[model samples]
Target: MGYYLMKFFSWVACRFSMEKCNSFGKVLGKLTWIVVPKKRKFMAYDNIIRCLGVDAGEAERIAKASWVQFGPMLMEVLRYPELIKDDYIKKYVTIDGLEYLQEAIDNKQGAVIATSHSDSWELMGAALAQYGVPLVGVAKKQKDSAMDRFINEYRTLVGMHITYTNGVREMFKMIKEGWMIGLITDQDPLWSDGVVLDFFNRKTNCFVGPASIARTQKAPIFHGQIVHRPDGGHHITIYPPIFVDQTKDKKEDIKKATQQIANLLENHIRTHPEDWFWLHDRWKSVREKGLD
Candidate 1:
């Protein structure tokens, strides 16, 4: 039932121009909030206050904006098949720091695009695709099979290759081809398998895969953020790549790489608190699992 509903929504989203679709998305977001803010409101409040270190009032404001962004965000994501067209790319996306990404590829070292859940992150991939980068991204499989297929297919509508989180062999093959693989380095990883890192002054388990991959593949790590402009367009600012050191100590290398990624994400979130998705219990590893 829900899958069909999403399919309907996707079809409707693609019918309108990107600007009109985005406007409709904001309306949807407001209706969603007014009708059913849902239980994530509690978690969103906690995350903003705990992670951003803001007062209750300020945290609530940031949390609300974050939730409000969902309408346009969902619209943008579902509009991928429509938005990835060449004309839309030139009309709406403003790309900067492109040379940094190109330079990494020029070195013959595959680059791991260290990404996070930011405003309009889905568009980030499409924007890069417009620039002719062979994109490969890793994501966890959705529990709903039909929804999973629907989502991933649209996710790669702009020429990206989406792989499951456990697709190690395929990732290795892509690395050998010097493809740029995108990994979200900020998600809370399993305490047992992940390394502890300090994010927003709190210790939590973070995925070390990007760092490990870079070290093993002799690749460089780069990060980007898609900031939503007031005019309804997005500007992607790609940061320079950070290379991992071959210090002989594997764990130490992982620690260094993970910290670099963590620090970079923290800075972006700090500078733009409302732009980040803060609904998830990102500190669960420390507060719940006692990773600290």
Candidate 2:
């Protein structure tokens, strides 16, 4: 089932322009928003309401848009083969701060790209790779093996390196070899592995790997975001590096860097309410352990 779906999407991506693919994706997104189970719908709405401090009606609107956004995002990813040829970075994406990332690369210590599951994150790595950045994207494998291979194939096709969710030690090794590692640390982590952190005014389990990597390797961490634009293109902003404090207090340094990451994530979600992956139960750890 997953393989056939991948084939179908890849065919559509090859046969259609990005605009047409996006239009189809918008329709698919709307259908998904309508047909998704109540649990998912409720979780999205609840998260938006609590995190954004919006009323139910407003939250519902944002939640629907959130689901819809994923459609185009996936389509864009599927169209990567075409995008790679057309110089999409120059034609489609408006970059705000390339120099910051270049600076990280120039420093020769490798770098950590602190990004999240926002907009076309897959494309983010692809774009960086196209621009000659040694980008290694950390991804969660899909439940189905076929689907996982399908996704990773597209990643490698566009020159982005792949590592599984549990590849932190591998990430460090790559960093030592001067590779820029991208970590999507926005989602919920294992209860035992994550540290408690304040996100959107609530306590939740947060992955400190990005912070840990930067602190241990003395690599600079650069926070970045990608968002859809009104012109049917995308905008990417690579912020300046967030240097970790080497105060001989490893725990405190990781905590502070992770908190800074959490703060950046909250600000991004607030600014682009509909672009985030709200379908994930981001605060499940807090709720289950009664941390809130």
Supply every candidate's count of residue pairs whose N, Cα or C atoms clash at under 3 angstroms.
0, 0
**Between which residue pairs do clashes occur in model 2?**
none
lDDT tens digits, residues 19-118, model 1? 8878888888767776544567777787777777788899878877776788888888887767766568756889888898887667655778888888
Question: Who wins the TM-score comparison?
Answer: 2
lDDT of 1 at 120: 79
Q: How far is candidate 2 from the true structure (C-alpha RMSD, Å)?
A: 1.6
Expressed as tens digits, the lDDT of each residue in 188-256 for candidate 2 is: 888766789888888879988888889989998988898988989888888878999999888889989
Residue 73 C-alpha lDDT in model 1: 83
Off by over 4 Å in 1: 1-7, 34-39
Off by over 4 Å in 2: 1-5
Clashing pairs in 1: none
